[model samples]
Target: MHQVHVVGLGVDHRDITPTASRLIDSAEVLAGGDRLLALFNDHPAVKILIKSPLKNVIDRINQEMQSHRKVVVLADGDPLFFGIGKRLIDAFGKDAVIIYPNVTTLQVAASKLKIPWHDIKSISLHGRKDIQPLLTALVGNNRVAVFTEPDFSPAKVADELIRRGADTFNMHVFEDLETETEKTRCFELKDAVKQTFSPLNFIILNRIKQAVISLSLGLDDDLYLHQRGLITKREIRVAGLSSLEIEPHHTLWDLGAGCGSVAIEASLLAYEGIVLAVEKAPERIQLIRQNISRMCAYGVEVIHGEMPECLESLPDPHRVFIGGGMGKDNSVLEAATERLRPGGKLVLHLVLMGSMARARDYLKDLKWPFSITQLQVSRSKDLAGDHRLEALNPVFIISAKKPALRL
Candidate 1:
């Protein structure tokens, strides 16, 4: 009959606005979570408790609407924001529902902390076990807010962040916001992982001032922990990374990721994306982990496995860097190119002329347009009282992009 009114009650019954209170008072049918429905125990309206298997709740609302003139659904915070209001709007046509908004829990959390949230990244872990997006956001953003779920609780989130070598953040947990039991506490990531919090909570992660890493592309080779000359040279890495054309949210693969230099640098560039570094050597894998922590590149993941084989299990890439498999077979290159997303870029670094020839022929056969650059870098070395330039080995850098449409 009449349009259903969905009201957002901030934290409790005390948060109901005058208009929401009037609507609830006159409602012939009221529906909400048990906690929300219980707040209006004195109301004479027929109350329906919102439950899981949400279809049942939708069914009840549909049935009640046939007999009632006024049906009101109660929601927490802003109804449209990760709330049931969207479900109602989708179930009924947009014209059949009217939504009344209120400040969201995230807004309150930010307000309580006196932090400006316009630029903060907000993620909802409710009913989601995937932590990748959260981790990605945490890597690139200085501030983030997360809505917690039972399975992916605040402590669990903290654990995941710490496990990924993210320790430079200060975590703020707001529990029972705006309610009698409201409690807010802030802790370092290490301490946050050890403490349990109320299920009704949100977490705020603010990166520490000193934890910010430089945005420059090529960091000094000496800054990373690597075996004797096993790392990608700074100039070569800079040239290769530039060719990769990394975007902020592009998933990248660093095959033969020696000390994860390319992946770590790409992670900084693609902070909102994931960089999978597949390295075969266990020693190098450890080194990659250490370098990732050193660079604060939380978005880079070090996979302790060989290339071509490890490529299958990874998410399809928007870009790939073949830095370590130069002298090896061309199968890794082929696999990486095939898995690249449409319009994706692939960059390869080769020290051997034969390897470069093989890669060039492979790209030619695939009909992929490509470019090659030879990098010859000379660095100044302190010798006795004079500085002499020492030439590093020349590297061949090849880059190609997968055509967006099949030829």
Candidate 2:
């Protein structure tokens, strides 16, 4: 059966395979975004439109398929590297499509760096507002590769990392991969921050022993200056952290930041991720700041404000911990329920049933998937030569996730 053919194109049209080029030039129906279309603008006898809203592209493919004309789908950088190829193939039968390949930006960057990609950590920051964490990852591993964005150029990334906390990694930027206009630079973040260049750039990051995860959150107490009675207890803090389902580079929010232990731990998860410590008390805010500093949680941000409000200003988080600011601030349960990314987790620690009821109700209203846990911890007390058990406090934790919404 004659069906649509999917093609992956490189920046230079000359890179197109002879068969792929012949298919594109002969395709009665051409489909792709402006960049891909303009890439072959001089080719005769075809129509094109800018891809937008994503759904439109899907519809266009469906439309061409009905007409039974040859349709060619074009993409760049492995299309599968955060590209549209997978979705298109998923919608149209894979057997009905043909994909031509080319060198991806990641491949070019690694080749120029003389580093094996398997040994490097990779991240794509296209259209993404953050790339700071990728810089931090360099401190633990060598040979990092990233697809960069315009505003968060290599310079901005270098500056933010060293400015925030990625001093240990060596950095490099590769421009116009695979072309004569290609260029590469290797230097420290401090030096890289001072320089600037073209938008067609990817980064290579390298780091040393700094990759060790700091599990000693206690020693960090001296570092952060937070408010009294506002922080999560180090003992109980593990519960919230565990429920977060955290990974390196996953964003987290400590809505009632308190002393910011959760946010600090979240930051420690990695620099590619964000940890927002939201609190209203100046004392706790100071403590949060100090904790972030002492703990070396460079990616953690301390915001002086209450939950829900402070949480609202940040991007949709991957995980959330409600350690303080419960009461009316339980509104975080509402806001979080709305902004919760698919599979994102929200965990709340409270001794009071009031907060638990609120969380339960909110999750029910949203029809989100959730689980609840109650923990009772006891302390050991000395009585003469005998030891007695004393209960510290019981905590109720509620964790919930919104179903993943996808194209």
For every candidate in turn, the CA RMSD to the true structure comes to 4.2, 5.6
Cα lDDT of candidate 1 equals 0.85
Which lDDT tens digits does candidate 1 get at residues 1-407?
45788999876557778998899889999999888888889999989898888899988888878765589999888889888988988898899889999888888889999988889898888666568778777766899899888898778888888888878788999998877899999998888878988878888989885343453578888888899988999989988888988998899988888888888888778877788989899999999888877667778887887667777878999998888856457778879888999999999888889999999999999999999999999999999999999999999999998989768
Q: Report model 2's TM-score to 2 decimal places.
A: 0.71
**Per-model TM against the reference:** 0.81, 0.71
Q: Across residues 1-407, which tens digit of lDDT does each residue of candidate 2 receive?
A: 65777777875556877898788878887887676787667766466563556777678767877878778877785766667777877877688766777777677676666656766677777666666556345434545677677778888888777655556567778877667887888878888888877777877777643433343443333344545444566566776777777887677777767777777666656456777777787877766655544444566776787656666678778887777746765456678767767878888888788878877887888888888898887777998999999986678888887788787
Q: Model 1 TM-score? A: 0.81
> What are the runs in model 1 whose C-alpha is more than 4 Å off?
1-6, 23-75, 79-99, 111-120, 140-142, 212-215, 381-388, 405-407
Q: Write down the lDDT of every candidate, Cα atoms only.
A: 0.85, 0.70
lDDT score, residue 395, model 2? Answer: 84
Clashing pairs in 1: none
